[model samples]
Target: MRHGRSPWMIRLIVLVLRPLLMVVTRRDWQGAANLPEGGFVLAPNHLSHVDPILISHFMVDHGITPRFLAKDTIMRARGVGWVLRKAAQIPVYRSTDGATDSMRAAVQAVRDGEVVTIYPEGTITRDPDVWPMSGKTGAVRVALAAGMPLVPVMQWGPQEILWPYSKRLRLLPRRTIHVRVGDPVDLDDLHGKELTEPLLREATDRLMDALTAMMAEVRGELPSGERIDIHTLAKPRTTYKPKEI
Candidate 1:
């Protein structure tokens, strides 16, 4: 991380903004204690830029300063890159196949006892029909490689804070931002096993499952809504059984 204000300054900023954001959105966070105080992986469903900031700020209360994975091009920008670098954000080269280095960086960060936040779906959701799109397996890889715990976080109200695909900013009245965090996922179960495609897919699916559940709660939607079961969904579809012939 580049030289900047001390950790106290960062904590101070978070201390002030936490209550302000809570008041503005009437937000209430649940399961915040699920956040690990030391190094850990934070995977959240990405809908807007606000998701990262909100997650980071909420985790701050638990004394976790999370770093993000930004696009490499953004890091190429002269001034903005300087600030991002100073803030310790890692840049992944999305345009090329050189993302391995970025992955390595994330693994190292976790190994060094820091919280690394990743938006597994990569870009924000554009389907307009779901809580999240198919998640990338990079998060799983990092967690498994570093042997760190993975925490799934879900965020809501950002889309309303700034409408999707629009330049207009609308902090509409009475918007409530709710965030829910789930317990850390243990990678020990998969320890010493080869991370084949099927295994990685299964693991990423589990990550998204937890995220989806938490997001539904945050959005105040029923948990039974189009449930996503990774193990079941990964299986081939079978013919429906007859009711009573």
Candidate 2:
């Protein structure tokens, strides 16, 4: 991605585009005051393509534009890549051994007073149930490593924009999106510790717990303790065929 101030053209585009987006989507962003003043990870559940945009667009009044830690593949398109680059979004390659570099970049962004948003689930949920799947510890690690607070963000209504398990992108009118930003998670006790898998997982569980609480609040459901166990979430499933053959 290229590095430079967004051209006047892009600024004008945003000026026109954002209002149009608000008008089209009729997004209602709650808990706007909960947004952190500076750089931090806005970790939210990943359900639809519009999740990031919904959260970020509403928070534009908060003074900092939210940047995403998108997988490097999204930049493959010549046109799309150019836009993302100009917008200063960070590219992250999870499969490569150098994924740590992305974390470092996020830390730097925070130090520079820029907000970085990430979906710790890595990708959207593929579970038969819509519950949040086990999230990677990258968000926790980044928070601890950067010595920055982790803000838990819970958003819904984007799912209404596009149906689950469907390839269709629904952009029709009258769909309302809700974004709820929670307070910054204090990880001061966990700061400066050795970055081990267990430590990271523990911190992540704390964050997810907060996220689930926020999600429940947004969805108007009772908060329960049915969290997924991250340790065993990735075990391969085995299938057995009948012996009729």
Candidate 3:
């Protein structure tokens, strides 16, 4: 797979953030060999807001530039939006007519040999114990549409630096972030099948199961129960305030 040059903005951002990340966190990254050549979908579990930074650090070190599917609100933010655009990230207009447009753009990016990182959980996990929760169908749809490998990249320890929904950062004690990239999910059997709701749900379950299992390996324990489905909660966990378990 041929590599295209990264935008100047991406280089500059990496030049600045890479050093800071190296200082603030130690990495226990593995499975670099599992990253396939050329373009593919990278699906990682969402733990904290800082996940993208740490995950990007890993991908960059392995010579892959990751394009994230960011929320449209962030894409429209004054300073941040400009940076994201300049860095060549894709914007996702959630719950809008433009959502389909965003997915098409992502699939094109993969076909063009760009690694697109999609957080399967869509948002930070609402699981009280910080385990990966159930996922949405976006990642599966993209991988299926593009006919590309869907790789599961599981991570832990970003929450130690910044807990979910918390505004504080704990940087004194440098944390060790653990990331493992699993082999591409086996979807060959379902590739030519119709993209039905049941088919999508099955693919998503396989993706989430792979992620949760890899996470269990990193955390040294299995999840206490079934993966938490955020939609089933009594109250939507949407605020920045840390929720009580």
Q: Put down candidate 3 lDDT per residue, 1-245, tens digits, no spaces.
A: 13467788888989999999989899999998999988899999998988898998988888888689999999999999999999889999989999999999999999888899999889898777788888899999999999999999999989888889889878768899999999999999999888998899899999999999999988889988788885676555755555432
Tell me which of candidates 2 and 3 scores higher on TM-score.
3
Clash pairs, model 1 backbone:
none
Residue pairs with backbone overlap in model 2: none
Model 2 global lDDT (CA atoms, 0 to 1): 0.70
Q: Is candidate 2 or candidate 3 better by lDDT?
A: 3
Q: Tens-digit lDDT track for model 1 on 1-245?
A: 22123255455556677777766676677887777756778898876656676777666656667578898888889997876776678899875777988989999989988888888887666434346766888888888888888888888777776544444555557567677889887566786788787888788888887887777665667444453333334324232221211
Candidate 3: Cα lDDT at 3? 49
Tens-digit lDDT track for model 2 on 1-245?
12224445346546877886767687667776777666677788777666676666665655556578877888556887877777777889777975878889988887776667888777665443345666889888888888877888877777666544455666675678777777887788788889899888888888777777777776677534455554455535322221210
From the highest TM-score down, the ranking of the candidates is: 3, 2, 1
After superposing candidate 3, which stretches have Cα over 4 Å from the reference? 233-245
Can you list the residue pairs that collide in candidate 3?
Answer: none
lDDT of 3 at 73: 98
Question: For each candidate, what TM-score against the reference?
Answer: 0.80, 0.83, 0.94
Give candidate 2's error at residue 188 in angstroms: 2.0
